[model samples]
Target: MTRPRIRWHIPVFLAPAVVIYTAVMIFPLVNTLRLALFSKIDQERVFVGLDNFRTLFFDPIWSEQFWNALGNNFWFFLIHMLVQNPIGIVLAAILSHPRLRFSALYRSAIFVPTILSFVIVGFAWKLILSPIWGIAPSMLDAVGLKSLFAPWLGKEEYALTTLALISVWQFVGIPMMLIYAALLSIPDEVIEAGEVDGITGMAAFWKIKLPLILPSIGIISILTFVGNFNAFDLIYASQGALAGPDYSTDILGTFMYRTFFGFQLQLGDPHMGSAIASAMFAIILVGVCLYLYGVQSRMRRYQL
Candidate 1:
């Protein structure tokens, strides 16, 4: 009997998607990286090698802002890792409890903010925290802690942290859902075995469930890292491109935006902007690599 011929139509089915992805994503990415190596000369594009990158890292005027923005971006990621993930895990644990009532309702309510546009969330929080509006101060007073109510968003020392926390509040649902799914995937028999082995309640979560959920936690951590580094919308909406006061909340994303598009007194510089984008891509690549090789590999070992 003749062997059936293998189908050759698979590539045809995937061709459109591949073509579109290349055009929209891959081509733009490659072009941007190429642009990073070129500079403009009297309205003409000219190759400049790594001069833009060198200036970004070595020139005093640019280096200061570059390092400052990079540091702020790391701190922003750290905050999400510390605050958001823990809160999400705890909320997930509580929501996953068998005894918990209205689980769906609670989940929906908590997740509502994540579905809102960054503009809406930013502006809404701005108004809610406005000193003139008296909402924040009044709410604090109702709780008998009025002195704790400061214009946190307006203070340079507090603006970044405040905005970071707001972003945390908005995005916490993602991790919570991810973790909740991980928890739900745990077999009842395995959980019962843990109970038989004297692991119950919090101990079960810590010793049994937590170990099984390490992979999901690692994924959440990496997602948080990427999201925090690439964050722009909330900061831009709330603090504007200047990232005031006096650029205290300026992160790489906003810095890249202002550099690329120009803001106020500054003229746009596409080469410098592309260099910044390339730097951001490098940072994110490094982070993902570390997570995959370091955190994820260790987690897999533990799972095995």
Candidate 2:
């Protein structure tokens, strides 16, 4: 019997990608985790085990900001899951209609924001929503609804929610495109079968199409979870690193940034920042695991 080839060429082809990933992603992640376990004490980096985590969670000065940022992050995620995903699904469903005219145009227009720079979106929206010069107030005034307009971005109660909605507006197109592709992939036979059983229109969607697209939705949910936790650009672009209105819009990303780089008079603390980053990594890891093992498994079973 001849021995199987070693497949040296396959590894040769994969080596560059592996090396780049290790250098860019794996090494940085491992280093961040390592940094989280040490602290600069008396100008020396000392191994401190979980002391950084302890300070992050239990130290009075740090705990409040950490918990607040965490709560805001949850709210941010909730808004995306509740508002953005549903809107995207609805848009996808509408555009996926067989006879819908100008569907491509609509898709392009909606998806345009997804490709725009976060800085541009943040700045543009800030201007459009500006109380003194924004068109939002003018449009409201034109419609005789000016009374409803307020400085949404400047208020503590509204700042976080406002930023969240802006983010939703910018990214809702992503899930729409995903779901639209899923909807389009539904076999013609399936729809015909649904019709034969009187499951037409919305009924067909709820019964047949939706079940088949559950996996896509599950994937989108996980993506949203991971993306929202790692979010920084939009918030930073719109609200600044301070995430002001008394830090109402501060999420873990901004919190970690402030700690890592130091803003204004606050000195940078890399150790604490690494701890925060590690915490974020852990949260995202757990979320992905739960979705993979629990939600994804159930989705597969449902599909089967």
Candidate 3:
């Protein structure tokens, strides 16, 4: 049997997209990685191989900041995984219930935060949580829980965790919406079959609906991973570039920002910044690969 020759015009259809992708994404990524290989020596730019990376890992000053940021980043991701996702799942499951009254209003109210600017959310929360002249204390007083309130954003022990929870509160709508959509995509016939098998209500959800939505959960996990790792805006807007309380809320994004752009006492080092950027890229790449191979491979998608 003879196979037909591929069309020469095939490239024409892909040319514009390929060109744009290469110019906007591939080129910048390649250039950033290349920049990470070199260092500034005195007044001159010189190729330093992996010296910058070594310095970032071994030098006490740089390594301390890098590790601190990286550790905090992991914790940030962990909080989202533990608190944000579970709440979202519960909310989604509840919202997905058929014959629920005022579903649209509930959805719109819950999702309103997601549409607000991070700056607004961050600063607004900052003000609300402030120790002085904020309504938090008054509200607590009104409820007779005044003693339980503290300046969470000001304390080093609570700063990172507080910011993470704030982020979770602001973004929970995302996973809820995604999971809700996934739940809706499930065929009603499957649920009916579950009911016939005595798997109605929660049991039906656990056995039939949950398994089908595994792919969507996997996607949400990956999205959360990427978003949390790249998170900077909220922290920066509320806490400034230093990410105080003494950099407790420091993450790779803020760390890289400090390195890339001079802040207060430190002069900007583009090479080291590129190295940080490359490290972030490496971490995200590893995470995505593990999700794809480890998690996604084991998750079986069900047809509706």
Give per-model CA RMSD.
Answer: 2.2, 1.7, 2.3
lDDT-superior candidate, 2 or 3: 2
Q: Write the per-residue lDDT of candidate 1 for residues 1-304, one digit (tens) a residue.
A: 9999867798889999999999999999999999999999999999999999999999999999999899999889988999999999999999999889999999999999999999999999999999999999999999999999889999999999999999998999999999999999888888899889988989999998898898999999999988888999999999999999888999999999999999888899999999999999999999999998888877753332
lDDT of the structure predicted as candidate 3 = 0.94
Q: What overall lDDT goes with each candidate model?
A: 0.93, 0.95, 0.94
lDDT of 2 by residue, 135-163 (tens): 99889999999998989999999999999
Q: Write the per-residue lDDT of candidate 3 for residues 106-160, one digit (tens) a residue.
A: 9999998899988999999999999887699999999999998999999999999
Clashing pairs in 1: none
Residue 26 of model 3 has an lDDT of 97
- The candidates, ranked best first by lDDT, are 2, 3, 1
Instruction: Enumerate residue pairs that collide in model 2.
Output: none
